[model samples]
Target: MVERVTLITGAAAGIGVELARVFSSNGHRLALVDRRGDRLTTLASEIVAAGGTAPILICCDLEHPEACDDIAAALAVEGVEVEFVVNNAGFGLFGYATELDRAEQLGILAVNIVALTDLSLRFSESMIRHRGGILNLGSLAGFLPGPGMAVYYASKAYVLSFSEALRQELAPLGVRVTALCPGSVSSEFQARAGIEPGLEHEILNVSASDVAYAGYRGLMQNKRVVLPGLGIKIVPLLLRLFPRGFILAAIGRIQLRKRR
Candidate 1:
């Protein structure tokens, strides 16, 4: 019989790394995917050192259109079945949408939207068979518009929407889907997005470990959405109190201010 495993994309760093640790520590065998083979190797060693199962590492970039299919093939060849999926590989470019390189912006959609959606749907069949779960890493930015990182925010909105709908559709089949929407996480994401650590980031920021813990706990509990931190949990309620135009302009200014 194929071994059942938790497959995590972007497992090389940030919350991805923490998620791997949490799941592995809980005795879940992992199939870790990332473009960085070296980092994946180091992580796999660390997991094994800590008395966890050695993870199956797949060093493939999710930006490729056939990436999800490739992942499934790789897992099959390893004689493993994906019982849980974590769609954590995503990036953002910080700038006005029009001013940023169009190709780069589209790459954002490629990974954040296309790849995430594809992987979720692809392994969902196996998850249903195994009565397993999926944990998608969304963002607090998904709740509102992002002016500087337009494509990134839009992509996360799609993640939030898609995860919610997928959750409902998969629940009856014994497949749990939970979107982990965190606020500013202290990770490589901000630096990659070219977002400077501002007051808002400081106020809202939570450690990747905390977010990972919340995600793991929530998924096991079959929660539809897991928003880590008090600050993150308050964001949606606060958004409800604001006018759309005001919220839009305010978020735009904040994002623009984070430039450089």
Candidate 2:
């Protein structure tokens, strides 16, 4: 049985919940964090019914600037020692930067860039001492500029950049940092990102569980970066081969559909 704790942000649903399940299966004790306490409780119950340990639920809106500090304080108070921190909680806006609500775009940066960065730094200090690992969720969108989801794409680009730098810094200390870049997954992300109800991304969508499993494997293998789906893995290469103008135009048209 794994005695080390793995704390996962956004553990109430989608890839976060899937991450929780995957980590739990490996016998890691989980501290599941999300804004939705009730949903987390429900998920905990299900996991318990399946003979897993009841996860400790941490309910906090990660949008608040101090959220990561607050969670760290709470864990300290609980005497919880985390072996892994999965920064998986994030959302995007599906519109032109000028057209989308300014607050919404900032909120995307808040959770995606700020909170994830804060948690990774704060937790990695301890992880380094213990020779543990961190897994950050990036996106295929991070490899290219996104016209419709400008802030979201930029935020993930930061994640990809940050994770790589941090990984190198932590490498000598025996602390692993893995960035999981996945293409679109069939999840609440589309609705939450304000994608159109009629928009279809079936061809690009991968399963959350698949991505979660790949993330888990990558983290265990001490891989620096993991592209979970075939489409996601091919994207960066394609980006390099295509002319910037052509790629941007194609992306613009695809993203424009979400705005309609």
Candidate 3:
């Protein structure tokens, strides 16, 4: 018998960890994936301690070309099918696009774009068969042009576009797709992106647990996009009200501050 489970990537920390907890608490079997094996084991132990089923952990980095395939094979060996997918594994670098290492910039696309797309399409058949759902973690950055973190922002934009289109195509097949677009989330992401928490992050920041709950509820309700915080919800509207050039210039200035 194939056990159906929710597959959550980047499950070692931040929103992914909280998402795993939220889903598990709601009685979903989970398959947690992260590059950090130690963290995965700790999370598995935590889940077990909390009375949830111990999740199947696949500690593989999504940056590799074969990572998605490896995850699928590992799950197959465990006799589990992915009933839900959360494409939550992604990162960014803060700098001028031309200044960052060429390979490292490509690594951003590898995990955030290629791996995300690969996993979504890879599990579509199983999700459709089970009337399942996908919850993609997009960012408020997706709606605008980012200057400091060019590749990362572009990848998120792809996530937003692809998820919306996928939602339309899958709705007829009883599958749901939702993009969770939060503003400045307070997480390790900022430190890794070389971003300092400033007035912007302070004004728009949402907690990881709150974001996870919102994402879970939104996915269950089949919302095409979920913007968690009240502050974040207004951003898309604000973007529409502003001129592109003005928005671009504003974003560039904000990003430039990180360099100092």
Candidate 4:
């Protein structure tokens, strides 16, 4: 039997790295992609040292438009047939929209929205042909308005909606799709987002390992959406049930408190 290859973006650390560990432990060959080449190389070495196969480390920034094509071409050259693709490369920004730099906002969109969506489409086409799987990392913030982190929240919302629709469209082709929605997670996300560290501790936070495990399980089950934390599981449903105005007001209040 041919060894299965799983391509995971942002695989140098956080949830992405945990997902790589999970797949590697299960005997799948990995193609770990991340912008942090040094970290990716260290992780690959550790995996190999631990007796699991070391992954192919692709250290290219996915935020660029040409990244998807470049990765696809590189994989072809390496003779790695991707049986699974996890679009997990993302970051968050926190601040009032007006206070944020336009270029920074656009950069966030390029990585969190454009890259993810384009990669999913490009990889899904191949997956459909091979009857493989795709897992997208969304966020609990996707369910409702996030006042300070507007663009990041909106990007995640797109991910959730896109993953669900794609799952439906690809069902007949045996190409499974899953969207993993996680709330506050113990990672460098808070620092990267410029979120107050104190605020993170106040919320129900799950470990990256927990999020990765749940995401992998849900992906294997072909679930359309998977919320990692129990407290966050009801957020999507509640957002759908409540009025949008009410949700916005609540989020605004929370943001105001955080800014204080």
Candidate with maximal lDDT: 3
Query: Whole-model lDDT for model 1 versus the true structure?
Result: 0.92
Each model's TM-score, in the order given? Answer: 0.98, 0.95, 0.99, 0.94
Predicted candidate 2 versus true structure: per-residue lDDT over 1-260, tens digit per residue = 32467889999999998999999988888889999989999999988988898787888999998888888887877777778999999999887899889998899999999999889988776787678899999988888889988999999999999999999998999989999998878888988887854433555577999999999999999998999876667777878888999998998988776666
Q: Which ten residues in a row have the lowest lDDT in candidate 4?
A: 195-204
Q: Please report how far candidate 1 places residue 61 from its true position, in Å.
A: 0.7
lDDT of 4 by residue, 135-216 (tens): 9999988887889999999999999998999899989999999999988887888888887755545465888999999999
Stretches off by above 4 angstroms in model 1 are none
Q: What is the lDDT of residue 184 in candidate 4?
A: 87
| lDDT by residue (tens digit), candidate 1, 176-226 | 999999988888987888767789878888899999999999999999899
lDDT of residue 81 for candidate 4: 76
**CA displacement after TM-score superposition, residue 9 of candidate 1 (Å):** 0.4
RMSD score of candidate 1 (Å): 0.9
Number of the top TM-score candidate:
3
- Against the true structure, what is every candidate's RMSD? 0.9, 2.0, 0.8, 1.7
Clashes of each: 0, 0, 0, 0
Q: Estimate the lDDT of model 4.
A: 0.86
Off by over 4 Å in 4: 1-3, 197-201
